[model samples]
Target: MNTAKQRKASLPERGFAWAAAFLLALFLVASLFSLLAVQVMTSAGLHTGTATNDSVLDGQMKIIHNYIGVLADAYGFEAETVRQSVSRDELRDFNLNAAAWWTGVLAEGESRTIPRWYSPAMEQAIRNAVDSAGTGEDPNVILAEITEKIDRTVYPLRESLLTTGLDFVNKRADIPGIVRSLRQVPPLCLVLCILAAGLIALLAAREVFSSLKYYGTALAGAGLVLAAAGIIYAVMQLKAMLSQASANLADEFGTMMHTLFLEAGGAAAVLLLAGFACLFIYRNRFEKHMAPGEEQAA
Candidate 1:
């Protein structure tokens, strides 16, 4: 026991132990960030929240009204006349369905038909317009013309809104696969990190207490980096950065990013605390077991 106590780690062993600790820190940080991303992307609650957000709903309404205004312009009618025909409940349902469809497509790795409520609303608007005008024109003929115009205009808009511009080269189908792979990353990284930590303990120290120093250093380094990055990202003026985007989009994106970063920062704080605790234990408890020379070397 005395002979073992006097033994010191060789320079090569110390180098390898340090390398392992560094890799452990790297893997730990990667695992944390990847886990956060997976949680955000896979969360149904997040998607629902974004879909029902007032800003997002208002933006959708504005876009729909603009399309209605175009139809009114073409047919020589008041835009408000057409807008009045579509109820708020109908618009809400459409937005909800659109959100659901987007979630389904990404999860299932396939394209589904886009949700549509505009054409029916437009038809009702035209019928009201014809009645008010006393134009004596057959409503069916007007409906057919208007329907054709919608197919050319509104249908394309719906498609563009739903499809995320990754329609070519089968990239859209790859989304689900990518998400699956990401889901595996955190667990894999964690396992590798644990292995690296064990390697550091084995290669650098004869006593378990001595290994705590390396563990504390690696954990503290990783925690500091993650906490700083997360806090900085959360505090950035994301909405201002997205000024050119539609108001609703900017607000929703900025809010989402803020929430995500804050959560990350909170998680990193736990890690930072754990790291400090380990260091404290090593200094107060472990140092008593070592000779002055050994303690200084450690």
Candidate 2:
């Protein structure tokens, strides 16, 4: 009983186990956080939130917004011209019936207009764009004009519309939520990492070489997991890129995304290698694998 009591008390003289566990946890989390950040930076739709330089979907979003805006202005002008001949009440009645029918026909997630301005005033001041798209002189010319008008009116709101892109607005609800959650991780992990490192250093000072084997194993496992994950993700990205239909997509954005995945994988690989080395050097308490001065470190 006396001997066991002395051993237990001696264990407190070595708080290195807690220190090792914390440090290991922090390192693994940091690698994961870096990988997630890389993923966000590489995606144009996602990068805006992280302040990553992006050319991906930002330009496209502006073009689409402008294209729709031009059509809206043209439709408004046409309707205003029509209202010049018709009485106000006639326009009101027509608008009410048309809006009711259009709204009734709309399926879930299908929006007739942005901002959904179905008010009487807007209705009277709007041409029936959906009904009159192809009923004009030279449909090709009309399309070209609309496209040009939109190009002229392009306004970029990329940074502000990171999670509000067309894809998400159309019902990728999960994406916005995931991004919001991920954006908070790096800072949280950083705090945890610093805390863990400080505690580990303190414990290490208190009990040198006390928990080397445990730390070594934990680090090695973390590294292996990270490396394996990165390798798998890189392979999957390569396969997906190969399968894409558009050449430009496959070559440009797809390649960029793939590269980002690989970068994550690379980070994971570094962690994995470091873990393996730690484990190898701390295989046993005997310190047989330690370098000349490494035992002092332990």
Candidate 3:
């Protein structure tokens, strides 16, 4: 009876187990929180907000914006111009042509800095047209001049308006939401603290379960999972980029990037915590596994 009583007293109460569990939980939660935050930002269209309407040394952005405006008009956006000035077919042509130009420019490494208000050819064409338009030509005459230049110079390339670009813009809008949530700072800090607590708890649990050798298995499994998540993320990113190039739905690509990079990363961290939890359980079990100093504490 005396020996049993002494051993029972020596064993830790429930508090130790609870603390370890809490730490492990926190670690997993923090990883997930980060993932969710990133996703929210991406979907809200804020990921590349800085890239919009900022100063352009050249008029490249203005041109792109103009194209966007034209596209919006084609979609029945009522502006100063009559809604029918550009037909849907015309818009499609413009979009296709612009995409081709962009692709070609990227291939040639000339896509980096958007040329100011005009490339050499565009500038020359515009100068000629504007000079004629300024001559107080009739409305039809002015339209004719502009149309001629556009047909001769712009229409020949692969300019086609498609819904793909619009879809990309629509999806990008969700990125702002994700960014807003992530930038809150306080919530993220809290999440980090929780994760830290979880890690500690997990370590404690490993100590408790030391006798079973479960910790080793847990760690090995965690390492593999983390590796897998990393690999998956990389593959997803590659796919997203390829889709961005080939498909019309740019927004979808952005979403995929967010999911694979942020969400998957969080999931992997959680897996790591599970491994730690196993370690803590192991540590609390077998005395032989403990270091000399820890053994004394036990």
Model 1 CA lDDT for position 253: 71
- Strongest candidate by TM-score: 1
- Tell me the tens digit of each residue's lDDT in model 1 across 224-292: 889777667657867776756445557667656666766777777787887788889978874676677
Better model by lDDT: candidate 1 vs candidate 2: 1
Write candidate 2's Cα lDDT for 1-48 as tens digits: 111111121465345656556566656657575646635433333322
Ranking by TM-score: 1, 2, 3
TM-score of each: 0.67, 0.41, 0.32
Residue 128, candidate 2: C-alpha displacement in angstroms: 35
> What C-alpha lDDT values do all the predictions have?
0.68, 0.45, 0.41
Error of 1 at 9 (Å): 3.5
| Location of the lowest summed lDDT over 10 successive residues in candidate 2 | 1-10
- Per-candidate count of clashing residue pairs (backbone under 3 Å): 0, 2, 59
- Give one digit per residue, the lDDT tens place, for model 3 in 58-130: 1222333355356333433322232234343443344344444443332232222221111333334334543
Model with the higher lDDT, candidate 1 or 3: 1
Best by lDDT: 1
Q: How accurate is candidate 1 locally (lDDT)?
A: 0.68
Model 1, position 94, has a per-residue lDDT of 58
